[model samples]
Target: MKVGLIGFGKAGKAVANVILQSNEYSLEWVLRQSTILEHRHVPEFLGIDSKEPGLIFSTSSIEIEELLSKHPVDIIIDFSSSNGIYSYGKAAASRKIIIISAISHYDEDEKQFLSELSSKTIVFWSPNISLGVNYLMFAAKLLKKIAPWVDIEIIEEHFKGKPGVSGTAIKLAKELDLEETEISSIRAGGIVSKHEIIFGFPYQTVRLIHEAISREAFGNGVLFVADNLADKKEGFYTFEDLLSPYFTN
Candidate 1:
């Protein structure tokens, strides 16, 4: 698959590295906010060995239509800001391009826009796109369904400087029908990301945890989504939709 990426921030760069190393993807280009690294190749920028074009372009330098025309890709994976979708989503939909977004948070209106956009082209969005985290949520939800009375508390930990509660933790709480107050967060050190769910029983406590050792987990999740969405029709999809089949009663 030929993949185009948006945003060259920390997460985007990590995802690009994974794409460059994967046998399943050919990174065609990257678009970001600045011109500092304009036209630089991903491999050269990251000091990795790969043969993909991996060209960098500034949004200010070219329009989305021109980029799509110049670099036709099989899919576009976005690890950019929550508002990044606004820029390229409609244009990509016009061309029936597939978009996989790993944006962490979106308001109701932004979400509705994506849901509507899916009518034109396939749109996959996941705040916590890690396979492990989604699986943890899936399993946690099942456990709650089978044992609804089990007391549940979610704990999320991140590195210093992360504002607000963890989005994944909030999603998990919502999935389990727990209040936002049921979530706890801790920020310290250089922790990449960590989420733990503790199910309390009268005599025992079962803990399910998913920790991202590195941002590459998101990259792997994208790879997984790309492989699965390859044969699906146009629609709005989530990580859970892609992962539910793997969990059976």
Candidate 2:
């Protein structure tokens, strides 16, 4: 698949490396703010070797559109900020390009815009793109079916710099039909990410945990979803939707 990427931050860098290393996808274009391009280690930060070819970088939507006109891509994976999404999503949707966004923390207006955009093109949006976290969500749903009366709580831990509750925790709580307050967030050290779902009964408790050893796990998950989405029909989708096949088996 020919792929375009937006953002060159940590997660974006990871995703870029995965695409570069993969034989199935080609990294055709990257979009980032002009400020990010000022970094001295642009190629190194994007995991692109000096000898690599066919990768275009741009800071404007018009440039991205021009590139798409010259070289159409099968999918566009976005790891940009919420503002970036707001800026670029419409352009991609107008061309009926598939978008896979890993951005979180959207305001009401942004959410509404994305919702409307999905009708015009396939949009897979999720805050937590890790396969393990998505599987955890699946497991939480099963646990709810097996023990509906059990009280459930989500505990998530991330690096101190991470803001708000983990998106995986919020998804888990949503899977179990619980409120955000039922999820606890812990910020410490440089932990990549960790989440635990606890099921409490009168005399016994059960816990399901997933911990990321590295960011590559998330990169792999993102690629997996992109591959699965190749045949999906247009609409807004999520990581949970990707778990449908597993649920049947």
Candidate 3:
């Protein structure tokens, strides 16, 4: 499969490296707002020019569409911000290309846009793409199923530069009837990702924790999603869906 990456940030770069190492896919094009020459190492790190990389730098939607037409991408993995989600999703949907975004929440406008493409295209969405977190979500469901009496609380912490609460934590809290549970966040040095789900009773406490020693952990999940989703058609899918193959119990 040929892939088109829509963002060049940390997560994007990490996913790109994964694609390069894997044998199943190739990097077709990387879309950005600046020329390749402007950033000295962007080309080297992205394997640009090594195998004749197709780097696209454009601010116009028409230009992006034209580039996609020329290259003919199978999937567009987007880690772009919230503002770019609607426009990029629309553009990719208009072309019937598959899209997977790091941003998860969809307002009414995005919902309508997705509804328009019901069977023709698919846009996989996830707030957090770490496979470990997906496994944690699965565990949460199992705990709820086997011991629904257990009370659950989720806590997540990230580096100081990171912003916002863990959408996954909130989702888990809401799922386990603990949305009102105390959520503690920490912003400190050298931390990538940390999450702990605690279930307690009078005598014992059960804890499930997933720690990310590096950003590559989350990026690996994104690459896994991109690689596995080439043949799937229109609908909303998540990292949890990707882990379903191993979730048989």
Candidate 4:
């Protein structure tokens, strides 16, 4: 499988590591800004070089677009910010390329971008791409059905270097119809990411939690999606869509 990555941040680098290690996929190109090198030594830290097979770097969407036009890719994974995502997403979707995005916020153009490609291509867009979170989402749905009246709250923690609160927790909150502001966010030491959905009522309380001990946990999910995406028929999808049908009793 040929794959391209957008953004070279913590999560992006983590996913790139997994893609490089996986025998089933190849890293075609990484779309990032030229000044990204001046901002931080990403390539040195990550040991990425353009000389490597299928490895290329681009500073603009036009550069990436030209690269893709010359060499079609099976999948393009966007782990970028809202602004960055829109630039690449438009081009990827235009070519009907399967896109797996882990961006947090969305815009009207971004929404319409996905809408246009929803039927002809497969696009997986979610705040948290972790498998554990998706499983947690599945569990939450069951809990909501079984214990409809349980008061639920979410708390999340992330690295201080991170920009904001846990997008995953916020996403889960949205999924369960909980107020986004009710989902708490914490920034501390070297913690990668952690989230807990707590349910409490009169006498007892239940908690569903998934903690990421390492960034690699996220990489696992991205790799899994990349592997499965190659064979997807075509359509907009979610992590739940990839998991085999399972029920809670």
Every candidate's lDDT:
0.92, 0.79, 0.70, 0.76
TM-score of each: 0.97, 0.89, 0.85, 0.86
Between candidates 3 and 4, which one is better according to lDDT?
4
lDDT of 2 by residue, 126-195 (tens): 8878888888878888889988999888899998989877767776787799999988899999898899
- Residues 1-249 of candidate 1 have per-residue lDDT tens digits of 889999998889989999999987999999999998998999999999998999999999999999999899889998888899999999999889999999888989889999989999999999888899999988898899889999999999999998888888889989999999989999999898999999999999999999999999989999999999989999999988888777653
Report per-prediction Cα RMSD to one decimal: 1.1, 2.6, 2.9, 3.4
Candidates arranged by lDDT, highest first? 1, 2, 4, 3
By lDDT, the best candidate is 1
Which residue window of length 10 is worst by lDDT in model 1? 240-249
Q: Any residue pairs clashing in model 1, and if so which?
A: none
| N/CA/C clash count, model 1 | 0
How many steric clashes between backbone atoms does each model show?
0, 0, 1, 0
Question: Candidate 4: which stretches are off by over 4 Å?
Answer: 35-54, 60-62, 244-249
The C-alpha local distance difference test score for the whole of candidate 3 amounts to 0.70
Best by TM-score: 1
Score residue 17 of candidate 3 by CA lDDT. Answer: 67
lDDT of 3 by residue, 44-93 (tens): 76664445354545444336767777777877877666656655666687
